[model samples]
Target: MDGDVENAPLTDEQVSDQWKRLADLINKLQARTDTKDEFNARPGSSLTGDDAWSPPFHVSHAVNACIVAGADHLHACKTLVVDAHSLHVAAPASLIRGSLENMAAAFWMLHPTSRAERVTRCLRWQMVNAKNARRALAPLDLKDPASYDERIATILEVAQRHPEIDIAAVKRGFTSTAAVTYADEHSGAALGVLLPWQLCSGFAHGFTWANLAFSERVEIPTADPDVFSVRFSTDLTRALYLVWAATNLTESVLKLHAQRSTPQY
Candidate 1:
């Protein structure tokens, strides 16, 4: 079926159930190593291969962000939580590329003032709304599959604009290198700088691994519990998730209907 019919309209209650189901699927995917390998195989490219598919990790991340921010902004709404460790999320290249570029642009625009912070905040806001927009998705009546072709074309346009984001420069400033690293536990690699000791003192001390193979490990520097010699932080992960989710949600929505409708928030 086409994307829209496949994603039939869910009443508010059904939407909640579907959202929960998606989250559970993500959690199960995370915990299954065999599933990850199966997903990574180019099944369609190989005639003998089983055509198994996995939800893109970025999409799951985006789902989580919508749940998180929506819970926060919608006020008194129930929160969604998933076991990240067990979720087999393979990071989508599209989200990684788009987020890196956005970050890079913001990094270049950074200044030691509230003005820069405001811009950063706005970018983050755009990302969150775009990602969790399902509750706000407008009505669409697809006459036929081709009716949504224009939306597909727009997706191509937006994607083509993303590679222009310069993640390399942002990494150089943070990690002092253009080379990004993949944590063994990550479905995809992360590119960012290590936090300086002076700046790391104020953060939380515990973290859990996702995507890659690693024991459930938590490292707190004896002197600076909040800082790490090597690792991704929950804060960073959450922010990245927000950006990824927004991007994918936006992309997915564009492909599902005849026209793009911004939420009325």
Candidate 2:
């Protein structure tokens, strides 16, 4: 993951600056076209229509780019092959929805029939490419020829062994929802993240620091009081909204991450 971007020949500081600029752009863009009730309304209820909804994907892609670029910068700066490929970079705040939409649009532009599937596919590929870029930029302790295969193997191992995530349990513990939608698109590899529920429910509050990397999507369909709907896509680099949550689920995610981080090794 770290190696892909590292080999780009860009300086660490330059890469970092790029990420910062990208992040800022995404933030401002989000602010300009805020997600309104209309946007969040039922699928057919988008008053702004299809064209207006495209911005989210753009924001998502830019943020993912930052992660990819940022990972490269990290590798270049630290010479460490971090597992940037895993479920740690798909946060709402980090992923630009507009990017996802744009990627999908471009993909379908080539093979129109596969448009729906292409959306997720392109996103997943972008994620892998970003990871590759990071891996490329990764620096090693010894100035010897770096083995791409070896680094990929390490990343795969890290992804496979990453701590398990339980979205259902966590959401239930934190929110007061009776039921939530658990939409999952298994067509492609989707990156999952835990979000701060308050951001969605809070008036004027927007995005929050998302727990970008999570193994999969688990919903609390049976939770009482608050209804939780968990939407997931195959695009590992794409962002999925809590869509709906009665309370802040950020604490639950934090606890989950903390518990998993506890070393048995």
Candidate 3:
């Protein structure tokens, strides 16, 4: 599945078809709605009582939030390409990476049929969110130091109440590095989610190895023998296909979110 978009070259017709599909998917994603975008009073998101259940937290807020972000990333990608008039070497893949990660998070939360696991994924994502915020604020002098801790405690408290969720599993929270692969399995995309994500990740980080793997390099003749100058150029077809993978995964998220969302009253 991941091999659907590989280092191997595609024919002209294949390129044209995939590129058109990419555009169509992006257009569809932009047009999609985020209905029932509401949330409960937090510390917990629940059905009836003071108990902060995980299910409502995801269905009501987190999934919508994630899909919205994925849409924004694709919007940004379009803006960048239009503004620059070309893929601009690395930026498209970087933007696509972010979109895929956002979609992957949403998919991971919503793909599960069991409500307990679904909510658990959302809880872990939020737990990580709080932890990150706390770490970012650690160097600064904050008025309330325990705010993030309270958030973490809140997630754990909810997890504790759900007997099906293993307490230890939610400790570290969610990270796309491991979960992206799992989410990709359900994406229903020809070009699977994980490889494109990985390729885009390398571009996002500006890794030399990623460039070496994906780009065409030609040695430049330099007067100074000591300076081994080289020119690197990106393959537009390859870049587009990677981004297409992101759109496919994101489109899946949008549809899944609609199914999971409460109907608008």
Candidate 4:
């Protein structure tokens, strides 16, 4: 059974269908309105307690951007391939790893009961991005904080305004791996998400353990040289599992955003 299973072809219609579903999810991003979301006009929707501010839109924008970024990474993973695609092992996994992170971050940012909690998560996510941007700005004025520093400072001030959140307790940077694990646990996916995500991370980063685990290998043991010659090939089953996990995670993000963005009325 094991030999036959190993030799069996990896052709399946389900993987193709999942890709189509992901494409559909990406299309929904366009339907969302930028100017008019009815969030501000709706009563009792003011989580910030200021009629001028729209927490839903402010928070959703970053979260949705994550979805869009994830879509780009996933789209780069073209199903169509020609010629020698042997180097495909690391590429798709790398792309899916990105997709997983985006989906997880979006889910984590929006997956809170209180609007303050959601806003705090968004602030943290943006704080990390701002700090990264500040680093990229070379020769940053050390004597006086630059605009990026001011931006982060403003975010910290905002974080302190909410009584529900403790700024001192929160970390400066968001952890994508923990977010991915949390998202997968709540995603209701048939297959495990964190394992696939970690496997992808490992494979994408050129980790030796992932190399043997993800690829098909035929080895020749040499006693004289105390060495072994090995050949590695693509493992389609594992590839399909990655696709399955991405599909579920992306779908969950889209669904959650749709539900959260729409007004109760």
- What is the C-alpha local distance difference test score of candidate 4? 0.65
Question: What ranking emerges by lDDT with the best candidate at the front?
Answer: 3, 4, 2, 1
- Model 3 CA deviation exceeding 4 Å by range: 1-21, 33-52, 82-84, 223-227, 262-265
Q: Which regions in candidate 2 have their CA more than 4 angstroms from the true location?
A: 1-8, 35-103, 106-265
Q: List RMSD in Å for every model shown.
A: 20.6, 25.1, 4.9, 5.9
lDDT string, candidate 2, 87-167, tens digits: 332333222232222222222212212323222322333335445555655564333335544543443342333133222
Q: Give the alpha-carbon lDDT of every model.
A: 0.27, 0.28, 0.71, 0.65
For 60-155, candidate 4 gives per-residue lDDT tens digits of 567767877777666555442211333377787898899889988988877776776777777778778877787876355653446777777777
lDDT of 1: 0.27
Clash count, one per candidate: 13, 51, 0, 0
Question: Which segments of candidate 4 are over 4 A away from where they belong?
Answer: 1-57, 79-87, 139-145, 169-171, 221-225
TM-scores of all models?
A: 0.19, 0.19, 0.80, 0.77
If both were scored by TM-score, which would come out higher, candidate 2 or candidate 4? 4
Tens digits of per-residue lDDT for model 1 on 132-206? Answer: 342234334324444344443433343333353232321222220111111111112122211211111112122
Choose the strongest candidate by lDDT. 3
